[model samples]
Target: MVAEEAEVLVVGAGLAGLRCAGVVAAAGRDVRVWEAGDEVGGRIRTDVVDGFRCDRGFQVLNPAYPELARSVDIANLRLQHFGAGVGVRREDDAVILAHPLRRPTRVPGMLAKRAVRPSDVVALVRWAYPALRPSALTANTGGDTTLLAALDDAGLRGELRRVVDRFLAGVLLDDGGSTSNAFALLLVRMFALGVPALPAAGMQALPRQLAGRLGDRVSTTRRVVEVSRDSAGWRVTAEDGAVARARHVVVATDTRAAAALAGTDPVPTHGVVTDWWASDREWPGPPMLFVDGRSGSRGPVVNTAVISAAAPTYAPAGRHLVQASALWGPGRPEPAETQMRAHAAEILGVDAGGWQPVIRHVVRDALPAQPPPLRTRRPNRAGAGLWVCGDHRDTASIQGALVSGRRTGAAVLRALG
Candidate 1:
């Protein structure tokens, strides 16, 4: 109703803020969402530049996220699924790891690769078979170890280890593969459910759908810079002098931003650089993520793939869009543009000179590092009248952001009662 007083105010129009606001509004509360940027989705942005749809950072939506149903409209997104599995590029040949159930016909092709020896295939089956059972999950109690340590203890070595290593490195963004086992298991469960995909319109479609449902409740281009309490309830003032008062304020910003607002320490993070390219030719076959068999040491690009092949909207008519990504720690120099292009060509066995550069995004705080002693969900309540939710407070992924938002929404509802 465009009232200055909202029962609940959400400071961030990204996934977390939108999801929380959606839940609050559905609960019959008047909630307002304020965003600093003109566009929603935060890091999950997609821009059409020179006929190429460039996603700000490399991201994928795991339809298997438990909280996904609560936040996003699955069927409405029109997701474009990636191929059943990934392709690992060895020296001369590419090894395909097709999901046995989804692509039964591709089983023979996967087995033909030298990397997938008979024993490795059996080991993969032994691991994958029982994992399908939800009951197979072991409780995440106190002690935890790195993913590399777990793989080694399980006796995964050589080509099999390298294949899994490269794949996890790409997905986890753990350059040294040191993320905690519990968190990695959570990710494994999500990945095992089905192939990840992009929205037919772009990644923005997910948040767009959430915001569309919110309608005019969201105020874009209004930055909520300060949250203070007077004798009244609470007041949130934007840098532009715009103000809104609410009983409760949810700070669904990034870890750093949230920490800055709350005067707390920011969560440690890992940086990632994604380079976008457009080419006249499409990549070889079905849409698949290509990972380096040599464990990222051979090149700056740990993985490269044609996103347009998986989601046609990523490129204009007859053009192809490719993405290559590398991860680094904070304060480290990002991989240069030339290094990324050359490394991508080396990994994909393509001509780097031909593909034109679309854009390069070096995100210093791309993801929260999931080191040992990990807690899947951090605190959602910043204080009695304030709250926070984002990847920083959750599992450090789009799924985490959604889940945290939904959780905080419930908390706010309970507080109101």
Candidate 2:
């Protein structure tokens, strides 16, 4: 029996689902969004503790994504900007190297560390010049090679290579050696060209803003248990025995969930764990990212930062919010809470022994594996009137999620017309 009819039904009210629904709704079509959880924003969630806003895991928004402006309100996000460079701790020394364009003053610091020698600087310019061409920056130079091989082809070695490998180990949550060269290059381009920021309230502000536009149209606690084709077009059933029928149904859930609901093989993914703590240390310079070169760090933390530096609102009036993260796999070391703080201290040379540990989040399917030969835009249509869209269908970032939504929405629109 048909429970209700919708012009378009979006399963999962994450960024992808919200984006797809927003697009269809803007065209004056009836759209409904069903979210299983008590709230929207999926992995992008923020918790308010004792008047301080702490994100579940450390994440940033990149303004360099071309699709962002078309999908969401830029000014309303009220983003908080992070410094344009990374601080590397190699052995006993700690040094910073900012992007020349973003932190001209810190260029000398990059040079001081020899992260990029004078000749390497010229090569770097040659490497980055193509980003000026909008088409060149947007186009994908297809490749099925590993990122390490791409670095070799680009002639990026020495300190540049060292820091990049170290940095990406944290970002990609892998050794950075096995990632797709094409995807890695795209990520590099985004990093070099984009401004990283966080929403004033927290990362959740982004999805919450999008969900607010739908008002009552987005329903939480309605877990979609099954997806099937019907005479009407498609049928999505909730665990509670309710149903939503529509001419087109988009499964915008995560890769694993989507695969399960669609009866497809689950994709490989990377698990990540992060711990947040409160510290009372002196200023650690700018709100820049800190990476461990693995030159002899004594802990599992590969990257850490006082995120409150990037966004003052993240912490209450005078408290500093610290976050540390690492990629997880077999043989991975997960030190206890105290050890994590000590490890962070060893990397930053800050004594965090007195800092208070607040929260720790572990996501088993945090990021979908992006191997070489990536199809940035995967086919969204599962069958007639059935579709799927998520970060797994594209690059593993907010850009990918929104882009998938846009593409799915466009495909649905063309089909209906």
| TM, every model | 0.93, 0.92
Candidate 1, residue 258: the lDDT equals 88
lDDT measured at residue 247 in model 1 versus the true structure, 0 to 100: 96
List, residue by residue over 23-114, the lDDT tens digit for candidate 1: 99999999999999999887778888897877777888888888887777799989898887777778786666776545657667766745
TM-score of 2: 0.92
User: Model 1, poorest ten-residue lDDT window?
Assistant: 133-142
Q: Number of clashes in every candidate structure?
A: 0, 0
Output the number of the TM-score-best candidate. Answer: 1
The lDDT for every candidate, in the order shown, is 0.80, 0.79
Q: After superposition, how far is residue 401 of candidate 1 from its true place, in Å?
A: 1.2
Query: lDDT tens digits, residues 284-387, model 2?
Result: 66788887754434577768888888888988877888888877765665567776677777667687866887888887777888887666788888888888
**Residue-level lDDT for 296 in candidate 1:** 38
Global Cα lDDT for candidate 2: 0.79
